[model samples]
Target: MIKKMSIVCLMMLFISCVKTKEEKNFFSNGDFYIDYYENEILIRRDAFYKKGNLKAIIEFKNDKLDNAKIYNGKKLVSQYFRKNDTLYDSETYYDNGIVIGEGNVDRWCREIGWWNYYDRNRRLFQKQHYVILNNSQLSNQVLFYKNGLLDTLRSDIADIVFYKDKGGASFKGKLIYNRKLNEKSYVSILFSDSIKDDFSNMDSVKFDTITFGDKAIMEFPVIFESNGRKNIRGIVVEQYAKEENVGDKPVNMLERYMYIDKKVDFH
Candidate 1:
């Protein structure tokens, strides 16, 4: 009799578990709160229309949204937001399921900014930026592209230098090619404007080219040599040639280098 009673109790427990497998809650308006289980553990919850259209879903990992939650409407449009244990910012789409816009919190500034735009298809486009400023007087800005690319950026600061003066005051200059790395161009500008009178006509010349390869190394032409220990000289590109390897073809290249001099005060 004792063994029989034990078996009957085990059977009752199994039935109880099965009953909980299909647990559901219904709202007064007829929306159903549905849940799914795996091995007697709740794994998913969803809300459904009276007509059986899925409206919203909350996925679970130990009863948390380990992945993401999705909200849907009667028109079959759906939007999803990533979640850890809480709902983060998310983007929403139109009835056609095309992304319309998205917004998120700026934890630093506690201010929220959102963007609304359009795509080539005339669909609504949107993005957002949140600013958190450490300094009250300074402002922050963020920029984004339609393709979700970061294009350019600028920020406000308390101090910035518009001009700098060392021993002498102002200088005027034009940029010219000074060197080449591979096929890339590198240029330097010669300052033609200064307050000193020591600069000569050689300083007026600018634009010197430097070639890089096995055939041509590098060369320069001197414009002016100072009389003192320090030389204030202008330089220009002359010519260059690279030696060929045993099995490789020979390569030859040439470049023009120029130099410009400006007045300089020694002391």
Candidate 2:
């Protein structure tokens, strides 16, 4: 008789947790309530707190998570827009109706295009740009401060296919804008295989400062045959609002390296 009663209680608990094909499921505890639909292609759930205050609400359409909103104590904090489970666009609030940050996501959910960020006071604090490079890889990202001040442009992986059977390791640059006239700049490239004595240009070299129109770029060739380790460390100094070569300061520098066990291949 005791074993039979225990089995019956377990059966009742299981039944309460799930809904039958012809029945709708609802559960509540004081200030919390939830509704579940089991027969839909994509089951949906709606939850609420005291006085029907929506804690979270997900509205699905045609078996897809179309849209959703999340709240904290009746204050909407986040809102998301999705199609087929892919988040396309979304916005987050600071509980005072201030948009914190908003941007677009690619199909793979990698952040793409323009992303806007705001300070707690709702002022435009920063903006970032992401570029999809070769083979759909996210390579370049440029960030700007308020009022279009160029902060930094970084390309973490600058891999490029040189030939059918040859490749090299590379990455994007740390570009800085030189606003002064005839701003001179040079870059130093450092290769990882450098030893204490007798190093060639492939090990390290400092190029002379050169000027360019609106911007100047320094490049060094690092060729490798056997796979080991490779790197290029560079620095760029420019005269900003100072006399020729006077008060010149390094505006930006970059150091990127990668390992190559085989030839570079894109296909």
Candidate 3:
């Protein structure tokens, strides 16, 4: 994704610009609060709460880092501008305040141009193409389908698809968990319905929906015959790379979304 965030922004571009002569206005360590005046740079961080109120707000000037906002109580959910060290303008929100993920950044901070993503009832799912191909920097994204059609989100597996504008590749499509869905956000992979149709030559399938730390896994679709490939699948779930051994709990079940080929278990 964005080439591993440009290799972690070239390995932490200056931390907070260093400097540090201490011209501070305010700085806290309890939860997060900063306002420095060029002392060490950074003007805001951490304090991002929700439900319990007091979302976010950070501002500073004489030190080069200014502007910040992230709220859920008053609405606004994101805002940014941490110049100099890079990270020019960023935005993201969707708890009702709208605005999913606008964009900015470049001057080497990376993530530049056309970044717009939405879908909390706002539609327009994705389209982030932060160019600069040969010079190195890149981003390339583009998905949509809340009816706007044209979708394809597969930046390395757990696939996703939706198409049909008119051009012929066969038209008429259907496979999003077979229609009527809302599994709370979905996470159900359970494999083995007689191996679903075999699919050799290295079978594959994925509808993408992953996250394991907080639990939200959905990567299913692996049905390779010849006596191998089944059980759990990738997205970062090691198990000898698999050939069918699966059992210790981890599960995935989201068929018809067009790739969740039966042997589910993201262990």
Indicate which candidate wins on TM-score.
2
Model 3 earns a TM-score of 0.26
TM-score-better candidate, 2 vs 3: 2
What lDDT does each candidate get? 0.43, 0.48, 0.45
| Model 2 per-residue lDDT tens digits across residues 168-234 | 3443223333322233432222223332111213234444322332334432233446444433222
Query: In candidate 3, residue 143 scores what lDDT?
Result: 42
lDDT for model 2 comes to 0.48
Clashes of each: 17, 1, 10
- Model 2 clash count equals 1
Put down candidate 3 lDDT per residue, 170-251, tens digits, no spaces.
3222223212222243333323333322222223443233432213333323323344334332122211121333787544
Which ten contiguous residues of candidate 2 have the minimum total lDDT?
254-263
Error of 1 at 81 (Å): 4.3
Q: To one decimal, what is the Cα RMSD in angstroms of model 3 from the true structure?
A: 21.9
Better of 2 and 3 by lDDT: 2
